[model samples]
Target: MTLDLATLFFVTVFMLGLGGVLLLFAWLQNRSTTALAWWGAAFLFFAPATALFGLRDNLPEFWSIVVCNTIYSLAYGLLWTGARVFEGRRPVFLGMTAGSIVWLLASQFSFFMQSLPLRIVLASTIVLTYCLLFVWELWQGRKEGLMSRWPVMAMVGLHGLFFLVRIPSVTSLPFPIGANSPASPAALIMVFGPLFYAFALVFLLMALTKERAELYQRRAANIDSLTGVANRRGFTELALRVIARSNTDKAPLALLLFDLDNFKGINDRFGHRAGDRVLVVFAKTIQQTLRPLDLVGRLGGEEFVALLPGVTPDITMDIAERIRDSFAAAAREVDGHRVSATVSIGTASATQAGYDFDTLYAVADAALYRAKQKGRNRIEPGRPSLTMVSQALES
Candidate 1:
């Protein structure tokens, strides 16, 4: 079936309008990502631009050529701005408006306005620039690991290539300005191409948003709300992976379990708020003392764990001591209440405690108990049981 210009124009408008409404609904559902709002507006602008293109023959030259193309250019510019916002970059309002400004000024020249080839090249250049800018913005966020980004990039890239080829194709064609009728081949291809592009992009954009939402949901589940560290479940999953890797590589790994000393007394004297501040301070201190490769998690109230890969028992002991000293210093006073906080740490190493997280945690927990029994604000070492060694080997 042959697609007439009117059919293509209505399809383009429908797709753009549908995309805009869906994106607007998405934006309303989650107002955090401003990119969605911008993209929604872009699609809205594109719907009108497509409608204006279909009505160009009935409208004045200024409305048909200058206003119509300017709106179309602004639509792509908004898409570029949305990409910039997605990547945490500042949107260029003046740059986005520049296309309309340039088109309006150029349309004032009768020769430029009357020549179809010149008009096509000029509009294509502006649109192509915005398309490439969108590509660059998405490419900048390549490290984010969004699976939908690849298809979005490919679609935008090919759209830009279409405009790029249009520059030369229009220049070589013998078509006149009046030849852009509903039945013309060029008009049909131009309208149909964007119709397909817009529909595909809407799906891809929704997929991207879904991917980000799922990622954030997973992180929220894994993260401790108060301390911003890994929760118990997250720590176990990550630490076990580290343990498995260490066992495979035959690298030394250490586990340190820590509990804040006199935590109950602080909460009783100063209140739970002060207790929370102390915990936050101690967690921060522990994070600062450890290497980036180390994993730390809050096991429960005032209880934490750290898994250190590539560290021996002696070095792990020293690191634990450092963490203890730093936390003690940092937690000396919370909200100026004169609350002195200290942490007791237990150290165990894979070489002695076996490579399993459970075995290491058991030894470390025993040593932590030993530290508490001896005195608070101290470190203790625990030896792995023979049973743990056999279990680790079997596993």
Candidate 2:
């Protein structure tokens, strides 16, 4: 089979340019994902670099050899920068240009610039370093549980490995002298390999952006923007799963429902901003008081709930009391306003209410009403009666 290097070069340049434009357009539509812009610029840079490399015969050795390789290195470095941005880290401007600087400096030496093997080694090393850095940045954010990240890491990792292998293969195997070298197997592989990779990389980049958008939407739906905790829907979904696990394990669970006292009065007296500060204060207090594994959510305005797994009735009461005390203390002064906020808490246990979220919630809510009736800022226990029924269902 015969291959036309000029045609392939043109195709690569066109495709990379198109991909860069598309990515830049995507970034314009959603300015939050700044990584898209960096990635787009990287692709755009790659187009000119590929052009310079392919047309090396027509251009001066300085532009074709030194400048071309430096641009390629810069593109890879930008890719690493994009990875850092994607993971919410600040881009290291120095690091982004480090590879190109090193390449340009090394190119100053006539012996260094003249040897093809030496040139290939340096170029491949720079690319491999950037690829590895990209992989590491993504790996650091693995806790986010983004499924799209794994494939990106794998692809970048494999690409890095290819470069690593190429460093050794360039010396041992029959390597082509340049891109236009006639249809040698090594030359063909070198020309086509990056073309296919660029295509796949652009596809993955689009997929990654799409995944992040979906994740943000899901979080927006589930999370309470005011308190930085779960909303009612999110809490219910998570609590149901916890209930099922507790039931399967025959372990006890506890639910604490809280209602802020005089919330509306605070808004009326101190202003809505102060009321917001009080809510934020209370949420932070409860979160700090609870165990790490415990789940808490804002059920609605001025009302919040928490679910504690594997907790006894006595422990549940203790936790509820602690939360009540902590919140009262924290909400005493909100943004220089004497808010004097307090909370009434209701406690229910799986031992009494069974492993049903609704049953536990209803019982806790009743207890909360009693706490409010008994002059707020106190904890009340739910009336226990469903033990036998729960055990029967379990059997």
Candidate 3:
């Protein structure tokens, strides 16, 4: 099919303009990272670059060859900068400006400015470098598990390869070349490739933003605001998964339920703000005493749970005691006030308490109640009785 360059240019300009607007809107809504703003600028810069190319016949040779290409180079550089920012890396402004600098200096030479193939080769090399760097930046963030990132990387990588291949073809092929009208296969690809890439890239960018939003929402739902531990719902979800894994692996699992003793009294004596500090300190102490693989969560105010995999009943009790002692020592002073606090922990093992989360939780809760009844600031072993199971089932 015979492609109309003017039509392609207009379509590309419109697509780039629309994409830029959408990205800018997304930036305004989130404002979390500068990556979105850089990408928005990329699209906006690209629109005018494409427009300048379309008007090259009408404009001066210097504007068409030097200025237009410089802007185009800046667009690709910003794309690279955006990728760097997304990956939490500092954007190198000098590296981004290098391509434009090279083009501007090279354009001053009459011989360099006169040869279209030489200019295409230089511009293509600069753009390809930026594109590859963008791919590298995205690849570095692979562990984040954002699936949309893979497609964006693939698209940019392929785009780079297209330019890489074009360098050789443009150098070899003889075609009509001028500021106003450049009839060549490379020129056609240049116009059409970015149009398709821009469309795909905009959608992928939106997908990335959506993925991040969903991740934040999930964390907010599952995480305790004050303690920075798992919330009740998150604990249940994670603990259930751990239970299933333990059952399959035949590994012992233990659950420890903890409640702060005289937590209400502490709040009354030291104010709610001081009480919050005590809770934070207690949570940190619990985290320090456990293995990295172990999971801890906040059930509610002054109530927490810890799940330990591959632990025996005796070892679980010892760990619980350690946590209790550590928290008790740590909570002696909250916000420089003489606020004393202690934690009561009740532990249950999978072998004795059963693998079911609800059953185990009920046994632990019962044990916790017993510990409170006997005395605060104590660790108690859960007794998984048939009555407890029945009660859990009923509840």
Candidate 4:
């Protein structure tokens, strides 16, 4: 059974209204995701805009055609604004209203008012621009790795393509822009396409919000709040996986254990705020020194760890030395204080320690203890145990 245009319009209004309320309620639960509020408002606007378009024959041309279509444009503009807001960009109020302004201005022209195809093209182009803008904003934020983002992009892109197709297909429909009597292919697309799109996008947008919240929760669990590095739990989880991979490939790995020298003295002397600054400084230094693939984490206060895969013992020693020197230099003046903080690092290679996180960690921790005993701000290499030595001799 086919749906008539009037019934389709009613369904669109009801669905859009329901979708709008759900989105707004979701926004109330999490005010940080302001994109939901904007998107909700856009859907609300569509409900009334669809109603006005449906009642075009009974209502005045200004209210039904011009104003209704202008609301449509504004709604699409709001969607684009929501996309920008989702990616932490400022909403362009003027840009959001520009489509409505353009529609209103063009409606005043006699030539524009008389031509049905021209009106369809202009309206479609306006909505298409916002659709493409939404896609572009999402594309720019692809690094965030949200699963829902891809489908939203594809949906908006296809919706935009539909509008582009609508421009050329408008020639086939009857003139004067009355109610779709028989509902031609273009008319059916006009009504049904948005109906389905609005329905699907509501669920997709909710999924996007859920995915982001989950991602943030995961990050919070794993990341050090003070230093913005992986915490102990996060490091352990990631490092173990790396170790397993190294073992499988028979590739070498290195672990560097770092401890700040006289951390308690610095905290007691300068206060905890200054101590925090020192930690941040050292964390930043190590992250800058290491490669992107390298795992750098703050195990706890004044202690950190780095796991480097596919690296030799000599290279690990060099990296540890570089990190030690960099932290010492960088922590000299942190947050405008005379915080001459220094780090002691211990290096361990998988060739000696074996490709197990626990084994590597034990060796590195022992080396760290040695560094503390020798003095502070020194790099020490872990010595292989007798078992490892014997295995090496046999090999």
Tens digits of per-residue lDDT for model 4, 1-395: 76687888888889988899999999999999999999999999988998898788899989987999999999999999999999999999999999999999999999998877788889989988999999999999999999899999999999898778777777764432222233466456657766896789999999999899999999899999999999999999999999889988989999999999999999998999999999998889999999999999999988999999999999988888888888888988978888889988888898887876766887889899999999888989988687755554454
lDDT score at residue 125, model 4, on the 0-100 scale? 92
State how far residue 100 of model 2 sits from its true place (Å).
1.0
Q: What is the alpha-carbon lDDT of model 2 when measured against the actual structure?
A: 0.88
Which parts of model 3 are misplaced by more than 4 Å? 1-3, 174-185, 387-395
TM-score of 4: 0.90
- Which residue segments of model 4 deviate by more than 4 Å? 1-8, 174-190, 333-338, 388-395
Model 4 — which ten-residue stretch has the worst lDDT? 174-183
Itemize residue pairs with steric clashes in candidate 3.
Answer: 57-180
Q: How well is each residue in 1-395 modelled by candidate 3, as lDDT tens digits?
A: 77788899999999998998889899998898678899999999999988998888899987877899999999999989999998899989999989999999998899998878888789889989999999999999999888999999999998898778768787455442222344567577667777996799988977886896787789899999999999999988998899999988979999999999999998998899999999899889999999999999999999999999999998998898889888878888778998879999888888886788888888889899999999878988999998765664465
How far residue 282's Cα lies from its native spot in candidate 4, in Å, is: 1.3
lDDT of model 1 at position 311? 96
**Model 4: how large is the Cα RMSD against the reference?**
3.0
| TM-score for each of the candidates | 0.95, 0.94, 0.92, 0.90
| Candidate with the larger TM-score of 1 and 3 | 1
TM-score result, candidate 1: 0.95
Error of 2 at 247 (Å): 1.0
Sort every candidate by TM-score, greatest first: 1, 2, 3, 4
